[model samples]
Target: MQRLVKIEMSLFKDILSGISGIFSGSPYRIILSAENKKFYLNAYKGAGAIPFAQLLNKYPQLGDLSVWVNYEKGGTVIPLGNLAYVKKELARLISEEQKNKPEIVIPQEIQQLKPSKMPAGFEIRYSWNDSEKAIQPQLRGEYWGEGTYVSENSYWNMPGFTENDDLWLRKNKIRGQEILEFLRAILPQWQRRSLPVQSEVVLEAEPACTIKINRVRIDSVTCEALWRVNPGSIAEIPSLAGYIIAGSSLGEGFNPAGLPLQTESGQALVEEYIPKTIEKVNEFLLQQHHLGMLDMFQPS
Candidate 1:
């Protein structure tokens, strides 16, 4: 790799690349920033392997390379330039992503439950299929409390969702420049054989009414009922609960409840409340969706 970059640099010295650095992360990056001329050259290996790593001493470090773009003094960028040999591309630098592009971690903007986007009663599900290379934004019907369900399907006098299914929220519009900029930044961070992945956000037309069952104290049984909530978002309508969060200090105003430990009493309720609260909360959530979702709750 270094050998090929050195060869490419020497060929363009005092010409294409007046100032150069051999390695800037993987894939040699050469930024030709002139007042008028500006070209970004990204170079890497083609069908070539590092002779040292695999101990392929006799095999060439770099054989055939596809050098493209205007820096090419020889072949075309696509069909023609794809035929250049490593020895042939002394005119242009080579990168690792010759035939295939590198994979990177997906940005948060694209894959998260955007809190800011929630207008009152709508949470966007941003997802992507990397295998198919497609970006699809979905309207997963989720909102904390009640305000106005803003979607194309939502009507002025629509009843509450009753069907046991994913209540698809329609008529939500979204546009974020940060998502694009985040995507562009990851292009350089992409690794040779990895995949990208995202998880939350807020847009102009979105919303969060989730009670994070958090353990506020690590040394004791102290908890914060709901912290990641909007002030006006509680009790208006039953909101969904998130996963249980642990690890905090027994701070001021926190009353550590005393309970019968499993070993200390005939029946244990110490480690039971939070977990049971989670179950009951979620159970109640289902009942709120519609009637007859459950015949009975868990027995005491």
Candidate 2:
């Protein structure tokens, strides 16, 4: 269900409603090694992000978020491909079903559909604030200072909320520290494979396009998939993985992340104006997701 980026109107509304809330929550930072450099991450707004947490307390119905947070429980999933053909195919199926059953029915997924850049699951890297740090010539996770993040993120955590947002990496329900240790165990190897020789990050940015979601099997767990997003260098690079969202049979799987990300707030507002500025509205339509430069990869 490629997170239904070809969206249902109701799902769109649900996603829009959760946008501000994603920004409203507290955020965690990931500091790898002694580098004080910040990572650019488009976690909340990237494809498959679950931005409904802040609203969950109020909207009790929004429960059990998947790796694909933007998707709501009750939306008709439009088939991926030419919209008209999909509709025509659905019509034919419904007609055929009606002939056999004598009951009148229609596609309830009657909502406008449009592609918008959303988020996959966010990667919150954490260590002690006083863990010691260093700085590199270029930004750690940025692509040649381009505003776009290599890996996708939803929203940057706002000021004043950083006091307490740390949670355990809950893979197999182990201590979050253990999860960190697991990444740390592979950190050296992952870094060697992902980072270039001069310790520089290669540029590998993709347009805001949607693709079919890939389901990766992991043992009853949710942990960070420690791989960078650089494409074309895959031959030399070894294994790669991303964020894992477990529990839900439908969306429970790994969402890939290519290592690093850095986000700029003011600029993001300018880029995200339309979707971000949408306040309370009965309905709104999202056309093609035309995110120029600012968008990262399309998550499955």
Candidate 3:
């Protein structure tokens, strides 16, 4: 039978080096990092003739010994039935080690925000208004509902609306124009309008809304390159590039009692909340347009 045992080690170089020495002869050794903790393990062959008691005597805190003895190898092996006892000791040792070695904290801007109670699945995204334009300013904000969707074709569909929801249909179309106007305002010098074929459907759910931006396109060209080295290298470049940003929201305030509603098809209320949520996003983009933010692309 072969046994696999894992040991939690301090991140200190000396402690890791000592464990490395103990398992030097093993053909394989793995060091893994997860959840801000480090682990060291060794795999070795075992025979009843070689009892684990001898190993435990040297390292009294061994937590567990996952053993797999091959029955075919003749069950004629010495049985060290104290595997459970070893696991108990190992758990104590790991807890003590974790106490001594705290996790490393990486510094980030999000950490500075006020600790507001956020609903589950909320997220934030950031990017330059014109990703391709070097002089463009970056915009960053929190997205409330379902996170942003990358592809236009992958959005979730609404059930009751079908083709008859006039309010839903009208809001969808107005949202598209709002996005175009937003880009023009942001980049006033960049000559581009909303893609003519773009559309969206904003739907309402109890505590949240869904805004689905569909088939959005923006037309524009690069004003001028931040650099001017070569022309042939920039032939296929677009002067204006459009971004299809999508997201959802749980309205303005956090409503703990307002549980997620269920649709007729049994989908979570968040699903129906997508279209109108995205519509609000387009409205926010329109606000940015009023502020004169424009989308940019390289010239073809």
Top lDDT model = 1
TM per prediction: 0.14, 0.17, 0.18
TM-score of 2: 0.17
Segments of candidate 3 deviating more than 4 angstroms: 1-16, 19-31, 34-123, 129-300
lDDT for model 3 comes to: 0.25
Task: Give the Cα error of residue 63 in candidate 1, in Å.
Answer: 95
TM-score of 3: 0.18
Best by TM-score: 3
Q: What is the lDDT of residue 93 in candidate 1?
A: 29
**Per-residue lDDT of candidate 3, residues 255-280 (tens digit):** 11222221222222243443443343
Candidate 2 has an lDDT of: 0.25
Candidate 1 per-residue lDDT over residues 1-300, each given as its tens digit: 232243335434523332222222233221221111111223323222222212212223323322234434431222211222322343332334343222111112111212232234433344432332223345533221222222222212123332321222221222233333323443223212121212122111112222332333332233233333333222211111221111211111111123222221123234456456435544545634523533322333
Q: What is the lDDT for 134 in model 3?
A: 17
Residue 33 in candidate 3, Cα distance off native in Å: 1.4
Residue-pair clashes, model 3: 37
